[model samples]
Target: MNPHTLHAPRAPGDIRQHPTGAARLGPELLLAVAAERLRAARPELAARADLTTPQGLLDARAALTADEEGDPAGSPLVVAVIGRFDLPRWVAETCRFALALPREPAATWRRAFTRTVFLAGRPDNLTERFTFDHMAEDGSTAWAGPAPQETTTALRRLLKTLDASRELSAWSPVTVEVPGAPPEGAARPPVHRDLCIATARVTVSQLLVQVNHLLVEAVLDQLIAPGDRLTLRAVPRLTGPAVPFAALRVDADPRRAHQLRAYAGLTEEI
Candidate 1:
């Protein structure tokens, strides 16, 4: 019943779209299109310091288009930049098209929509990892992540709930306690649990900014520095009752589990 063990070279439901002569595009072009669309949809996202900057975005696209790399699977480049706050429904939908990478255009689009919905309910402080697949000669590429049926449905429900919830103009701050800074005169407490904090109210936009900062810190701590070569595989794991979710396993060296642990920490939401 292990889900990650199975690798469907092709998803059973896949119905690929083959673009003819003029219609056919290179992988780089397809990625470029995806990136441009994302930029157009959310020009405001560009200014956020905590999230991937416009410069970082350009670098990712340049890497995708570069001819030097051999295997598409080997060069797992960052395609999309997600931060802590939730994305607008329209923007998230647009991103799906970008992630589709010119394959199964219809199905990939649908899957992207489903995935976006699933993400809506997740904690705002979640760290995101968006890697890209190289463009094949035919302009088709594999999905960035696995999509199991049960997980998809679960996400759909979660998205619906999130959509229905009233969006506040502001919310109480989300904070985590760390070891206390002891008073100079007092002996350092034996246990570090005691600390001082009060939640700060933040507007929706402010919340996104805060999350972006958290994401940046988390990635720096957990992920290998950007441009460090890496590899990935679909690792199946049971997420719920009879639900199979294909988790990604990334490594700088397959023989070393340390990097994998770091990758896991980076991708952990909240």
Candidate 2:
């Protein structure tokens, strides 16, 4: 993971010089420049008449764009652009917000819940880029991720072991056999945990791909829970009105079951 320090410019069009002598553009201009570069690099896609611009990207640009009365420091988009948004804090907040909402049917809730979480930072695709780890107030880690795929693999292995154990009587002297256990002469499973944490400096784009492997441990312990609902909203500027981006309800029980099936499918090859 490449770590980057974001320095917000004081005004529109102002260029900030990093310690390494690299110039940093203001968020709005930076995005605009990126958009132009993409358009240039993918001319055919940009020219496609049937393709419409993404609303989230447009909204992000609008939010980041500076106006005479607007202050860049006051916008959450700016914070995200600078890679300063506290993701874990926002994830907790989103969870709390969802739980407080009126419940709905499982299907209805999952659609909404997943949509809200997925769209939180659509322009930057935060969910795919960033993994959230929930550390409980009791000093317990509830979630960690090396990435979603690896986490799913770990959870599936744990679940399979659990299923095997259930098939045997508690008083049985014989050990419950795991399907993929090492051969009798092979080395035993390692007792020490192999923790993989991303500690390298990262740019905003690179940081999104960095995964914390501890999330796999959380999944193995069944510590993760689905929230009932989430509504993703944003204030373009400090004085601007709050724009409702996405909202959805999720039934916890159904969502949990759905997640199990999804993860099982993801790791079927393992």
At residue 206, candidate 2 shows an lDDT of 22
In model 1, which regions exceed 4 Å deviation? 1-150, 161-270
lDDT of 1 by residue, 1-270 (tens): 000011111222111222221112233222332233334323443233121233444443344334213443332222222222332322222223333334443233222221222133222222232222322222222122333333234333433322222323432323232212334553322221101111123233322222222222222222222212212111221111111111121112123321111111112121
How many clashing pairs in candidate 2?
16
Q: What C-alpha lDDT do the candidate models reach, one value each? A: 0.25, 0.23
lDDT (tens digit, per residue) of candidate 2 on 8-107: 2222322232343333322443333333322432344334422123333343233323321163222111011111234344333323332333333222
How large is the C-alpha RMSD of every model relative to the true structure? 23.2, 22.7
